[model samples]
Target: MVPLKKYPNYSSWAFLAVMAVGALFCSTVIAGVTGQFNLAPVGIFCGLLWVIGGALCFWAVQAEQDLAGTGLRSMSVSILLSFFSGVVIFQEPTLLYFSVPAIACMVIGIWIPASKTKSVWKNWRSLLSGAIFGTYLIPYKFSSLGDMEFLFPFSVGVCVGSVLLVAIMTLKRKKSFGYPKIPTLFAFASGILWMLGTLAIFWAIADDGMFGYAVGYPLLQLNLVVNQMWGVFVFGEYASRHGRIKLTLSTIVILVGAVLLTLSKM
Candidate 1:
């Protein structure tokens, strides 16, 4: 496949904005779906949405995309909207006081800059992707599927959708059907990790309902910290003294926010 066009002057701010917007949309869906959880096969629709979101999000992160910025933005949005909806829409009356601080910290943390960038289209794609991913859990949560039952069919849907996307991409690029052994193995490993995370969340909600969301969602945002570490140490993102300080403070704040969000469950 031909390489994408090069941008003579890439704008980090623009890229971050687009990525954050995508994250916001994705988080909105997550909150909305989980708030409306029920026992039906509707998880298939959520799975499809998640597949779309994942495609767009990865598209933004492709080829030198700032993992830290994109991840932080996505998590910030998810943290805020997830709780806001829990309190307002889902009527989690107990969460209001604690959620205020959590939301505040997320707002402050996400605003801190993290990386430079190169593509507007990539950001847009990420935005759409994040929005869809945020919603995939709703149907299964609402469904009467036992923990394992929800895990099986929803996971199947996600896998099938993802495989179809891969097939479509291969066809579009006219790439030969071959996977590098190491990369395929790594991908399988990643798949296992993702499945484990999904199962953990499903189990939480299955056990506790909306209260599960109160705690689990914030825990999920902890990925922001991990992603930032990868960005700073592995990818050399936000390497400058100023950027490092920002990221450090952001991490602290995000942690506090997560704590507050978890406390809301109390």
Candidate 2:
């Protein structure tokens, strides 16, 4: 097993990521036979494939040994999250929710990291994917299908999952590639946690979009911000570059922005 302390170089991580993609392709091929047209199967399948890919990736660069505890935990969490999503169905939105702050949440949820990490706008790619995810949980042509309000939860789950994965992968990647480094993958897991919870939020929103936005979004975002601050949950951010004081200030600002959003929505 590769020691966590001994970072694996970027080339090795990239190899694993590429292999993960191939695994995704392989899973996609397998998913074709399944009667379901939803992306849930593919997404859940990809989660496993990433694990296999990560393991293979690990083996390729390091010695032949089982993956580490943290890696195993991460995979387990992802699997559980996807499994939870698979059982639930996405419904249409019944309430009205949309505005600048909502847009800001969506943007910051995806953008902040995009700028700091790799591609800032890359989260948008998951729009279709997230929609697919939402569709699976929700019945087709539901009464509120035209509302599109519930898209927030679905999209957040997708956006967070996509970017956070990239972030975590980078954290584990060794320094050979020269990309900015994170000390550990522990924090990145928070993103996964929030994503998992979002699955519920999407399903809930499908039932009642307003509550989902006013209640659900705030709960989720608050949890997320807390995780970001704690640095123990998934994708937690520290105040290194921004500094502790600055981070605190930013949190307050975001909270205020979130409150404004809640008020506007209400």
Candidate number with greatest lDDT: 1
Model 2: residues with Cα > 4 Å off, grouped in runs: 1-98, 105-199, 212-219, 232-242
TM-score of 2: 0.34
Estimate, for each residue in 140-235, the C-alpha lDDT of model 1 and write its tens digit.
545666665555445545555666666676677776444444434444445555556665667665545545654565567677688778768866
TM per candidate comes to 0.76, 0.34
Query: Which tens-of-lDDT digit does each residue in 1-266 have in candidate 2?
Result: 12221444433343333333333333333334543223333334334333433433344323322122122222222322332343333322222244345435433442232224433133322222222332333232233332223333233233434345555766776333333335223223323433345445555344444544323433343443443443422233342555444445545655665565455545
Root-mean-square deviation per candidate: 9.1, 13.3
Give Cα distance to truth, residue 126, candidate 1, Å: 3.0
Report the CA-based lDDT of candidate 1 relative to the real structure. Answer: 0.57
